[model samples]
Target: MHSQPSNEDRPWTPVKATGTALKGADAGIVIMPGDALAAYTAVAPGTARLTSSRPLCATGPGKISCQGIQEWTVTVRVTRP
Candidate 1:
């Protein structure tokens, strides 16, 4: 019979938070939100889990500030079963 691998032995991969346009704004500017939790959750499922969180870094609101141009930066550790 085949045996399942242990959690400790599972392969792990690091996931980085990627920013997307929260609203209609200039594509030249790059905004990174400090909220790691929010960023982690934003990641697609079955991708990875937040292992470490980093501070937020962003530029002043652009033309779409009213549209909420928030950004996030998060570090995730993804493991495969």
Candidate 2:
């Protein structure tokens, strides 16, 4: 969660494209400035992935078109002990 890749101009944000095994502690997507700290609760015994994505380049006028994307993932496993 710490020392990960991040951009100040274009920061990395969570991708809720699919269902996740870990549910967010907050009501909705929680993203703080210059930080990606968030809590999640395991709903069931399974494996889940928390992901974040960012464009390769900053999109703006006169800037190079962003043709690629970068992603970061953290795998979480929940089991009954």
Q: Local distance difference test, per candidate?
A: 0.31, 0.65
lDDT of 2 by residue, 1-81 (tens): 635334664566754423456776764765565445567877777777777877777666775676787787778887841
Candidate 2 wrongly placed segments (more than 4 Å): 1-8, 17-20, 27-35
Q: Write the per-residue lDDT of candidate 1 for residues 1-81, one digit (tens) a residue.
A: 956433222222233433332212233544343322222222333443224322222224351123222233444443422
Clashes of each: 3, 0
lDDT, candidate 1, at 35: 21
Q: By TM-score, who's the top model here?
A: 2
**Model 1 backbone overlap count:** 3
TM-score for each model: 0.21, 0.62
Say which candidate scores most in lDDT: 2
How many backbone clashes are present in model 2? 0
